[model samples]
Target chain A: MSGNENREKYKLNVGKIYEGFVIDHIHAGRGMKLYKDLGLEKLDCSVAIITNASSKKMGKKDIIKVECPIDRFDLETIGFMDHTATVDVIKDGEIINKPKLSLPKTVKNIIKCKNPRCITSIEQGLDHIFVLTDPEKEVYRCKYCETKYGEQ
Target chain B: MRHLLTPLDLSVEELETLMDNAEKIKADPEKYAHVCDGKIIATLFYEPSTRTRLSFEAAMLRLGGKTMGFATADSSSAAKGESVADTIRIISCFADIAAMRHPKEGSATVAAKHSRIPVINAGDGGHQHPTQTLTDMMTIRALKGHFDGMTIGLCGDLKFGRTVHSLIRALLRYKDVRFILISPDELKLPDYMTDEIKRNGAEYEEITKLEDAMPRLDILYMTRVQRERFFNEEDYVRLKDYYILDMPKMELAKEDMIVLHPLPRVNEIAVEVDEDPRAKYFEQVQYGMYIRMALICMLLDISL
Candidate 1:
């Protein structure tokens, strides 16, 4: 095969969407988690998650292609899940915009408070909310119990 | 509606106003006797804390308001798995305000979020007890005339004493306030607290022996050091005596110095020292009620 043919064969498996979002450079093996966290599986639109894709910046990366309007995406979920992931908004089969992601100030119903003494533990229908108390350390505390995430 | 989940929930100015009102209520109780007439306060003790529940009830009763609600989880709908949000929402329909003490940290905050009426956090596990901190502040201001320029020596269990941590945070807002933390190495104030003291430009010294800090202190706040907090019996025996405030250690303190404790203290402060005139822990209880009275009036937007 020619070099051009070889490059084409190695290209990403997913096709571009007409007007949707392309989440690129997700840390390898995190694309599925990002998909689940964003609740993309519940959406009616088509979504493709490519794992261990070749990358120059990263040794390997994951990419998510969603075939839906940009407004339909919850970008905050992506920011909370993986701030390093770059989000490209595609329009008419062209990359329209690449939005920067930063840690969200607060997240709702994403992470549960593990502290057994937390009110959320016994409450029947309480949302597990966390607030970013220390942005530098990326520390999140349960909104109800103020228990640091992953603390014993 | 307002809620006192933590001491920091009230700004410095608001605290001043609350203190001023508390003093006024202390001076002439009759003037504010009927300020909260026809009002109701629900004492929602999801955990059993008799002292705090009684304080809230007494505060409301003194203000001509009636009090209601359960004193323990088993007696309340919480035993049947009622959520804090739902309980508080239901309480709001009956009471003008609520005072809640829960075994879980941040439970009061959860109640406050859903309630239509104001919620005062009596205590929440080891998280916060804003009323206790407020009472401490009231006692200091009543005795010392102000919160500024005071050297406070906090002895015993600095690591897990919620009142001590809340008091330190509250006092850090004042000027020229220094902390002399006296605790064993194992129970030393956490690094986050010391860092917070430094970050706020407040001065503090951590020492193992309480006697060394006695002379320079304007106030000595004592908390019980539990036996289980130590890893072994030998360390507990060696360190237990150092934390106890007795007449001998009281001699090293300045004559005008006051001693305070969030009580139910287990022999940490000797009975002999209680007669020292400067032992203000009992008076601290009275101050707790006064502050709660002032707090309820303020939260209900009632004025004399």
Candidate 2:
């Protein structure tokens, strides 16, 4: 395939792999790194963007943008960036989604309240429901486990 | 219906007004259940405080109002780097009144700075917890018959207990009340507080031993020596069990002397003490809910 073909190869449909947080690659022409998770130690790249993912996980629905070397990464690794962005992408013109992700009265994580005595954080077989009490502050609680809300 | 951000907001008359309403609620809770109907009290707990948050929410609910807010940090927009002002500003539009707790000193006051609705400070990071003071006031009035001429003992974590400081400030409003401070030297009352004690002409005495001070005490209020407040875990480990009260300790007091605690106790009092007629902490907690209920009812101007 031609070099232009290589550029469009991983274009937009890049699988949800290859560190979805990868938003840019400013080739510095030196040694770089990859897969900080399993300790890839090092790789070759100019500059890479890592994310402080506020949303907890990465998904295609959250993809702010992705910039890359085109051939070096795979789909799954790229999917992790689904919810984050690189400053370069915005400078290069990528719009951030205005609608913030929220914990709508339902949740997925097991309750982890420090109060072991708290009912919802302990009792089994109950749905963990937490309304978006404050969107600016990401907080949640088990509805059944914490009954103060119900009493209200 | 302004924010109860500090004890200063509760003038002696307003404080008595709240106390009278709370006492009325205690006497007949059902009558006031319909007081705050159709109103909402958004309890924005920026910090996790099961008891304080519950007290306020229970108050609103019992008064026929509703509540909606988070119980922890991860559950708030603070996780998203949202400012306190932004959060309270939004919650105020939804609630007729709100109560909040934050780890930072003056955070509730900061929230009050922007809130259009009445804001209550349930507790703010070792700073102010005025409702607990009101709870203490209502409790003292109910159990001891009057706040005047009473000898009040505040035991444990006195140096760092916001509730203790708030209670002392509130007690000053009463006549001839003498304070007996009991705690480890590492946790002695704050000098600023002692200054207030002196300035108000309220008499006080500091004691390291609870049993030593028990005989003369009219009200013995216990507070936990928080593990986090100690710079040395060894100090807390060495001192917590040392200050605990058992059934034997009650013998040193007047038969009708009341015992109060900010609940969620970690063995500060023996479980067996729960049976004693003098052990009023549970009822105190219940009264707390009613007092908060009455306050919310009056603050929001709802009809019972």
Candidate 3:
């Protein structure tokens, strides 16, 4: 009914962690992907993903709550996925910091280079890295082949 | 520690120095014959480019250095699924420097990252070929005497032509260099390249017809439609003969206009055009050796 009510509803859905991160305002349907990209599943800690959550800023959004330390958390993955997403640092049952996320200058082992002709495609055990070449255009090119991401 | 993965690896001043070194080597090659006497060069060509391979080998041999390596991917450890990183690391142990050509774009960069020695990119798949650009620049400087205020016409296969891309990038550093990009509609320069040209405030005109841009050109660069770059044989066949540089096209060019091609030309330049004094593609090949010789010396820190 109200902004506070919506916030309360989300808080009720996922319990607050003692020490971890709460990635909020993720674009709708990207929470699971962010979870996978961050490799949260591989972690031994409890992780909660909320999809299609109502947002005042964004019409709908996704949120991820990780019940673990922030040391292993990948902020670059979150930044590359959704720069608008707010990362809330939790400590002792309280939000200590709300760090702003922006597109990473370089992302490693996140988005894979799709260019078949790229060395990363054939080489085994190589990190798939992309560099933000054009910040204005938000263009990411494969560090190996220079092939722009999503290019045919 | 210095690797030539692209022409931009060297600054404008460094390029000028390298060019001067190349010119010196060209003038008196015998004087610097023993510059690389104890050096060893590993030519790791993971692609079949006989011209580039020979040019590198010749450059090394002329510098009194020994050359060793496989010519094709099948003949190398790459055929056994060995990564470029591993091959280059191994090559670094045996050779003082390495020149590598691979079918995959940015393969040289990967090799360079793992190499303990200097890595020279001979040619990568439809990507930047710095050595070829060096050769082109050397030829232009020798023939035209300067890079500024030159209207260079680049004809055919601009999209997949690595030399065209590299040459454009290298020439864009100069003042008042206009580019007449002559290529078919489907094979025009890539949008990213055009964007770079515009971003650098370089003047360029894209035209489909070669003759239309010929007469006003100071340098006419012809490129073969690379069959290897094409995914389909039908597309390759259709574009292969799009813009042939012949006597008719040469007739339209300016008298002082020098023609350059990164060779292994396949019907792109007719035999008739080869007789013209303006056709300096063969001289381009010779410059390729000289520039490479200069490049090896620069990379190896060998001063003569």
RMSD (Cα, Å) for all candidates, in order, is 3.5, 15.6, 2.2
Q: Residue by residue across B134-196, what tens digits does model 2's lDDT show?
A: 888888887777889999999988976889988998888889999999988878986657867
Write down the lDDT that model 2 would get: 0.68
lDDT rank, highest first? Answer: 3, 1, 2
lDDT of 3 by residue, B151-219 (tens): 999999999899999999999999999999999999999887898899999999999988899889999
Candidate 2 regions with alpha-carbon error over 4 angstroms:
A1-152, B302-304
> Among these predicted structures, which one has the highest TM-score?
3
Candidate 3 error regions (>4 Å):
A1-12
Candidate lDDT values, in order: 0.87, 0.68, 0.91
| Candidate 1 DockQ, CA atoms | 0.64
Sorting all predicted structures by DockQ, with the top scorer first, yields 3, 1, 2
Candidate ordering by TM-score (highest first): 3, 1, 2
Model 1: share of real contacts kept: 0.88
TM-score of each: 0.88, 0.65, 0.95
Error of 1 at A139 (Å): 2.4
